[model samples]
Target: MASENVKLEPLGPNKTGPNRIQDDGIDDYDPHLHREVESPTTNAETLIHLLKGCLGTGILALPEAFKYSGMANGIVSTFLIGLLCTYCLHVLVRAQYVICKKLKVALLTYPESMKIACEIGPTCLRRFAPYAPAITNFFLIFYQLGICCVYIVFVGKNIKAVADEYTTNDISLTLYILMFFVPFVAIICIKNLKLLAPFSILANLITLVTFGVVGYYVCQNLPPFSSLPSFGTLFNYPLYFGTTLFSLQAVGVVIALENNMATPKQFRGAFGVLNIGMTLVTIIYVGMAMMGYWKYGDKIESSITLNFPPGDVLAKVIRIMYSIAIYISYGLQGYVPVQIIWSNYMAKSLDNSSRKSLYEYMLRIGCVVLTFLLAITVPLLGLFISLVGAFCLSALGIAFPAIIELCAYWPDRLGPGRWILWKDIGLIIVGIVGLCAGSYSCIYEIVRSLASGQT
Candidate 1:
């Protein structure tokens, strides 16, 4: 009976323990008694927030990715990747809900889910359980910081490109990074996401407008279909994998978005926010990649934004608007890691006092500064984005979630004649291959380009 309890226990947050689950999957303890902050996000707001997170600089680089995969492969592969990502997110969210029901908690963040999964996994897998939170945090921190770095590079490079075209002042990328640093820090300091919701909406509107302007340009003088290959060479598929993966990877923030929803149940319904948002995002990605590739062919720059005519007013406006949109979007991405560190690592170590509050402020500012410095040093935006995509997205988006599903459904599915095990194993293998191949290719290209004295 005791052994049975051990195998059939309800997973605890950040630990393995046999929590007593009621018939309704609720614990006897009341969570509201201890709850502090009220999460204030409606279904519509959650959908909008998710859309904002999904649309980022990766979409701007898709034409170059299409340059590698060609238009036909680009469309099919992108939709497939989006579907896979959504499936992984669904697995992760379902696991969270199961654990939440058992633990009698209203929410479980991404890392907490990792810890819980490890806790409930097989006895053989339990030995390394203590490292789960750290492992998850490490990936989450690096990925979020990588995004901030990408934003810094995106803002700095585009702003410098536009400014250099119009004026004789050839400003350094570092200067633009510095100029944006203060505002970046200011935005990140807004602890409550509700406060930043309005900015997210505005940023998304700007992104939509920029997309329209880009489409207009793409339609002006479309290149012949024969000029661009219908299918690219096999060697370039890894690059396509990395860029498409990067463009759609928002796994880091899915739990955060769902947890904050006023009606979290609606997040995963038939026409839920997740499905709706991903479908729309996939459509937009396909449209942009197809149009951008058809227009520019192999001449597409790392960022399609760079391909815009320098003197055109609408082009200039789009560039500026994109910079600002990405700048605002940076805070939303950074918020997850900051919250993780503060809640998991720092807050517990410090007491409830004015100095602790001050420390939080300093920590947020320091993170922004670190990312800015890193971006300024290695500002190869496209390659860096691909590297992060291949590494982080592979782990967070594919590998971990598949493992979580395995752990969540262990004994029943672990026995003979279970297809779940095989499916997860396959996903894990695919994810590992993608991570290794994509990362290696991206790094090799970056090194070769640098050696040949190219950006």
Candidate 2:
């Protein structure tokens, strides 16, 4: 759908409207808060920003996800899941425009859209309208924090792998965690999006090169066809789903990215940045999953990066490259919660304080420490990634978007025989099923791993 064509009828006095929106047409969320800095992201910059945001440590784990679904199922499943995710993103963007048009507002954050959608939907959903924004923020906070923890584990595991080869004195993961903790804190403290953009660009370049190098190694010394399974056990599908979902979906930051665009109107077009970026991301992920599995088969480690030979200097360089890239990414992912918490609750109280800068820096540093401690405690990279994906992202990625679409169009545009209505319902069902199955599988694996002393 074209972004320009997403117009809706203006609402009457009965429906909730943004009567108190800022004169400049931006909503500062709370009356006490000052207007947010105007966004300057061009389409190209937004594209790069999103590409960096979506692809990360999770992409490296695709080979392991392939291990669950096998070659035959993995290819089809990855494509289907990727398509579903893209469509859900479309639904969310469209819903944002629809809600904006009806409410007579210029912009809406993801949580604000959620609240509006719920309030406008059928009477049954209206009761829960007040809680929608909070629920969305809760998921966004934990999801972003979970990603930070994954980055910590990713960096620690790779560094430990390299350190084990050269040094006889085995270094504990905790020490490695401490080693990177300070730098991570330093990175997240850079709060301005423009300042962080350069780092994200560098991170994306490193990831692209890392993908190319990874592909080169996989191309050489490929596994025999006989060694690869065409179809995997049914029980492993959920685990596969969780990892793929984690790797592909970036629902938590959808509105943040769009609202920050130089022209937010371009964000929902047929050839929009979201579609183009997600399309490229899917192709790269599918290629990595299929090729990595072809090279390593069932023998693939939890991360394909770990499968590289220890003594190869190039391999070590790639590991270090990826560690730096993922470390940079920690700041980008953490920025979501940082904005939510700091702006809404902390910023007002601290902004007027004489020690404002000190407290703000401390808050950022403390958040980094929180994620580090969790990463050090759990340390199971693959299992932890899947757990967060299933439990948190499933809702953000699938169920919530579908719900948003339904709520945005219900009883009027989607009354009867409307394909959009049925389509949304189907998507909701798919999302709910994935959420249940993936959650069960990930939790079970975590429990089993704990019992076996794997974590």
Candidate 3:
């Protein structure tokens, strides 16, 4: 195993120790200071990865939900949700960079990244601030897998639709699965994020092409779009906001990028770039979804393929490209969370005397099995994702950051609230409100949908 692997050279970040990361936990919970191998990533590279990973694939299919929700409500929901997500992304970035800076200064391991920012406790969460990154990582892998499966379905559908003219059946479902297996397997073996940088750049270009095609088509048919639906269509906003939360979810990406930074010191830079890019992408995304909905009306499906009329060659080609690009995007974006969950799972193996490689395989298999269970049992993928993400990831990524930061920054405000320090208390209240409003709306819709048997 050692010889088959190229020795992991010090890319940039220092190693915490060569003691083979205590996966099975023979070591104490105390932070390890030996420098860890810096993952092959830069602030700039992380920015690109975040954009391609978060914005590229989901934006294509999300308009389907908007169409279901109706135009007026759809656009409104998109903006409001976008605003909430923007805030969540901002807080997660600020919290992570703040925590990382303290960890580096203390010469602590990344797992203990929160120790300097918060008081330690017996639980791994308090000791490690588990929910923030660790819990979010779990759901992120699930989100990646869900989006990947959606991509695969879209790829097969688009190809079959177009290719059917050329051959009786140019691509079969079996062939599609078999075809993706090689590339998917190839991606898994690529070592780390930096090696895949070129692919990330190409994927972003593909997204731009998708943007060009979708934007041009919608703008060209503006009159037709407005006439399709009007103000009475606003009722579907709740569910639309609920389901499409998938698009705004990037807190896990924030944490992973921070972790993988070659120089943790550069988190401020990476985060700055990440926020700027996301702002621009959000504007483009809302526009695309709105225009796509307005142009196609309620006839759209979750993958954008349905909106492209059967006879238009350009639309057909766009569908095919969008599907394939999303497939690659999901697979690539999925890898980080996969590594993250695996890392935490392996932190057990690395930290313990009983550490074995088999745990790695088990973790992967476990996730696949769980995804299958949820997908089969749950009627709506969007609702299922939002449920898990809101209760878990959103809490960890958004709420926890605000809580931890407030606690760390303003200790006096931690006392019994109403009578306590007003200034800091107000900030906490606003954070809680945003968290509750955003999370409540999502969770409420999921529950309501499930009750009505819609999800």
Candidate 4:
């Protein structure tokens, strides 16, 4: 007999063993036992990666997010969004585990999980299983490309800030973006993950130092709370929703991190890596938003780094360092979409071609150019962040997970009294509303900015 802890017991003999699943319908499969990761990541290592994933360009935009929602509202709403995002992440992972156990698979990517869940779900959804992976990949690819575009704008704007100090001539942000094109292409062309690992490490370290310096500046000369509004106008709340969602949700990498764990089971539960990491992330985000907003008040820039005094030598150094950090991250961020486009769609066609390597390099350069064009077209960082967050993450981070959970559990196993069903429904509704409202607000802002002759 299988252990009591096992959710499903296999029929006949050959039970109570790792990676053992009989021909019968029953399954005593434990995903953890079956995993064959050659170099599994420890819990602490996974936590660090989680932190690095969540703490990207989004963190720098939270204060501006606060600018949209007001300090008090921003604090409260950000925490709530963090909670929601965390819960959704838990939902997705739990569903993945359940589906993996049923399928007797050691691991499944986000799209794979969605596809398998839909295949085994309620009768109505089984037919849609074929399309799930493509849809999921669509969101994943779009979100990653959106991130690359943000990095482009972020690096360009920071470099522009530093150069504006040295020269009185007004250089277009487009020119600065163009200046870094070759370097961006050079870094993106490096296909070896091992080579890129060092750059990722350096970027994380630089980000930490940048945040520390930013904290120092924001902490000094704090403004009184009475000067700022407790709640912003309703018109701007969607922008806040989008930015906070963008900042708090790192759904793209959650499954990847969980799948690579040395002990995958330690990724969830009360004190699991997910909870602890997200708690610290939420706290950091809230602290940055509150402090940055309080310090700069209405004068806060899209990135808190920009709000730093330009004349200060330290501020210039910080800007340059952060620009370098984000520039490095562009390659890391761009890697995802490139892989999805090439391996999933293009590589099969060129399997026997001698110039396959040549095509891949061209694809990489093409992605850089695509993001460059997008960055130059809508150079506004805050609006672009909001749009991407609202449009892409809303679906990937929130709605799709809820839908996946619903399908994975199906007609039964939806918790006592079907509470999970209702809860998932609520999440799906929230995601949809956030997507629509946030996207609208961002587009409106972009159009208004254009009309006002602002970049």
Residue ranges of candidate 1 with Cα displaced over 4 Å: 1-42, 102-104, 192-195, 352-354, 413-416
Instruction: Report the number of backbone clashes for model 1.
Output: 0
TM-scores of all models?
Answer: 0.88, 0.88, 0.67, 0.94
Candidate 4 per-residue lDDT, tens place, 99-207, comes to 6666666667777777766766667777888898798889888899999999999999999999999898999999999999999999999998789888888888999
**How big is the RMSD of model 3?**
8.3
Give the CA lDDT, 0 to 100, for residue 341 in model 1.
Answer: 77
Q: Which stretches of candidate 3 lie over 4 Å from their true place?
A: 1-47, 97-137, 163-186, 192-195, 222-236, 256-275, 347-393, 413-455
Instruction: Report the lDDT tens digits of candidate 1 across residue range 49-127.
Output: 7887787888898888998888888889999999999988887787666655555565566666667677776676666
Best by lDDT: 4
Query: Which parts of model 2 are misplaced by more than 4 Å?
Result: 1-42, 262-266, 349-356
Better of 2 and 4 by lDDT: 4
- Each candidate's number of clashing pairs is 0, 0, 24, 0
Q: Where does candidate 3 have its weakest 10-residue lDDT segment?
A: 1-10
Candidate 3 whole-model C-alpha lDDT, 0 to 1? 0.53
Query: For residues 294-411, what per-residue lDDT tens digits would candidate 2 score against the true structure?
Result: 9988778777989988899988999998899888888877877877777766878876699988888888988898998889878888888887888787889898898888888865
With a 3 Å backbone cut-off (N, CA, C), the pairs that clash in candidate 2 are: none
Q: For residues 101-175, could you state the per-residue lDDT of candidate 3 as single tens digits?
A: 323332322223333344421233345553444444444565566655544545555665676656764454445
Identify the runs in model 4 with alpha carbons over 4 angstroms from their true place: 1-26
